[model samples]
Target: MTDMPLGAPGQRSVLRSLWQTQRVWLASATILAALAVFDPLQAAESAVFAVGALLNTAPFLILSIAIAAWAGATGADNLIAKAFSGTPLLMIGLGALAGGISPFCSCGVIPLIAALLAMGVPLSAVMAFWLASPIMDPSMFVLTAGVLDLEFAVAKTLAAIGLGLFGGTVVHLMMKGGAFADPLREGVGNGGCGGAKMRAPRPVVWRFWADADRRAKFGKTALSTTLFLAKWLMLAFVLESLMLAWIPAETITEMLGGDGLVPIATATLVGVPAYLNGYAALPLVGGLIEQGMAPGAGLAFLVAGGVTSIPAAMAVWALAKREVFAVYIGLSLSGAFASGLLFQLWTSMT
Candidate 1:
């Protein structure tokens, strides 16, 4: 009997990989396709809206990508690695501040985290960086300001740093009581590509074009960042259109609207399962607020979803013990709720 061709299995594996890698794009296309078949007018209107939205945000998107690419080429993250050598309290403070404002992209932060943990960095400082880094970066701030508002962007930035400080402090106290000793998982010391750079960061070379290699690196980062932002935003805008069309305003107002901590609490819980990405979450939050969800609720949702998102949690699991991961999640949830509560009070006073 003739054996089945081995190429068939290889082709199937290739297709599977493509599907996994491109799920976001595929989901966006699928939504459009379904809408086109069921309601042609709605599909056309959504397409227009998504395209228009992207065009409006184009300037901010360009600036955001430039900042990220520039930071990458100039070795800003190397500076980040070097900052981890101070006292726990000092390091925690630095961690929170640097993470919130750092131009380093999210892609590098994971490896950086791995490297720090591997190098025997204190869990408290690492937790501070870990919580804050994913919450807000330069790119996130620009996109939030563009899609939401300056006030919301500013609030989110504060929330990021605040959450970091809170988590770090808690972890520091717990560790003082002898909790979370030797937290790293087995077989995880290397920082991968990004980690290596952080471990022994080269000095910043701002005039990247002066060197051929740096010029190439700059170009690559720019192109990749642009594509990364573009795809997520497109999917987010499209989903926003669908949400606006289908989800009733009254339902949103009733569940996630109004004064009090109830809406904020509700939003924090909802954010965990609903959040697909930081980039995608902004438009949805904007859409939710447009439907009358409170501003504080939006902040809570953004913070909660960002820290507990699947990818973020998985990264923690990859490097730390189960207990440490649990602590991380616990801190994220509590901090998110508190942020929402505080921001709600602020908005009311203002």
Candidate 2:
């Protein structure tokens, strides 16, 4: 009936796309299968731990999902779009402040940055947003509180805003002195490479439930957010269980637990390379904390990894000139270390 023989092409394409998205979950399943074959008891234990952990996180997970969905349905990013049109100094500060709270993901930042640049927003303000956006968000705040604590979540939010201010100020001065002449790479603002998370601004409807379209949008956002968070978190919990079973606590303590700044520095460095998915890293760090890793090291690793993580780096590299990328990386590393040091001092004091 169809022109295509065997009908395999379309089916294969769908299957391949699914596999790419599900590979992490597949890996978790594979790990369980292997464990079951070799150590059935341990496999059961891991499964139990993962389920329990997920259950414990369910409240935070629900709240985060709801927040993300609400933002999408109500178009809260309209506020972010409006924040860019002002004096350069004011714009930069506003940009960083907005970025710290914005729900823009790594994928979203690409199009948002490109859009801002194309609209003639100054580089300093854009840089502030770029630097801080990945550091924190509303859903991230809720999840961090659930995984870590309320105090930690608040500290990270402050760190995100502070880093934005710090980076924005430096970049603003540099631009004044004739650095970063032509920051964008060729054809960056022309378009984006898909996976855009921020939609164009629309008027916020406080009662999204009243509108059928908004209700559908909310459901769609919730489902997608849930799946994305679920996969990474599932993989993270599995890895954490294995790390607990296999890796000795003494090793984690020796490497990342200490009074001086060495552990924080080490964490900052290590996070740039060793960090995995943002959601996935949470439980691993929590596991490390349980193993006596210094809280400061944990915070440093999170900030450094969140900012310079592969997705964030690749987006910058693909969109901006090399110098811009350099400054971004430099700021991220330094800011992460400073956040850790301050957090450590605070923890020690209190």
Candidate 3:
């Protein structure tokens, strides 16, 4: 039989599927092409800047994805469950701490939360973990340090824990008031990732590599995560380049430069509707900082974006009642504002 041509139906279907999954890459490429057409010199400079940013953060990105893959393959969620299976108060505290270190994005956390709720984990514990997980992670910390500074990264990590604690306490108090008695909306179990089920805990060493299925799982998870992050990082760097090339420094400074409460509040508000991933936000924030955006405002923006971004909120809404969803939003917004203000004060004093 003759060899089929590359343009056969099978190949066409495969290409279509690839494009659907990686539309961000296609979109970014289209935008870059347009930029090149409009201004070739600026487009070349922007491409260089974007590539440099990607190179600078590649190590941390790889490390984070590897860790996340290992955790997924080795059943890290079960470990989280065991750690939080103590007293309600202890669960809350430990859950908050776990949230800080867990390698999950906001949307990625929804499945875990659904699993925990289905398993009868305390709402307080779930609340703590849910509130904090999106804001920081081991990989996110390193990425933040690479893009911004160690101080900002450390402060953001601390803020994630603080916000989790605050959220836990509030949920606990509300539970006492007979609120959130039945927080899960219908079909929550059907929501989020279908494959997020917790497996039997295994050793975190070489066991994942030992089993063929586990190895495949790890590889698949890591590759998908790397590609996902790369897409966002590319877009973020391009936007950063545009901001640097076009937006006047004085404009950014005038809007978000001050240490005052107004500027901080504005940043927080802006972040709520802005659709920036945690990793992607770093480069944009770095650009803003270089243009004199206040450290406090930048911190606020990160917290707010992580907490209230559309994807995160949509996940919350899908799994919870309107009232519980409102509380989630309220807690996130309040925590973001408070953390930003405190960070500002600390930065000023030092």
Candidate 2: tens digits of C-alpha lDDT, residues 1-350? 85655548888787789787687689889999999999999899889977886776676567656765675577654454455555778888888998899876754555556556544556788888888888898988999999999998998898888899889889989988987657776544423322122335568788989999999988986776567556655666676577557755345445676557888999898787566656777887888888777888899988998898765776677667888899999999999999999999999899
lDDT tens readout by residue for model 1, 254-328: 566665788899988877656656887788788878877788899998899888875566567655788889999
Per-candidate TM equals 0.61, 0.61, 0.61
**Candidate 3: C-alpha RMSD after superposition:** 7.8
Candidate 1 residue runs with Cα over 4 Å from true position: 1-83, 104-107, 190-255
In candidate 3, which residue ranges exceed 4 Å CA deviation?
Answer: 1-85, 190-254
Please give, for residues 163-251, the per-residue lDDT of candidate 3 as tens digits: 99999889989888877766776544423322223345556545768888888988887776566556766765676677657755345
Model 1 scores a TM of 0.61
> Each candidate: what lDDT?
0.76, 0.76, 0.76
Q: After superposition, how far is residue 35 of candidate 3 from its true place, in Å?
A: 21
Minimum summed lDDT over a 10-residue window in model 1 is located at 189-198
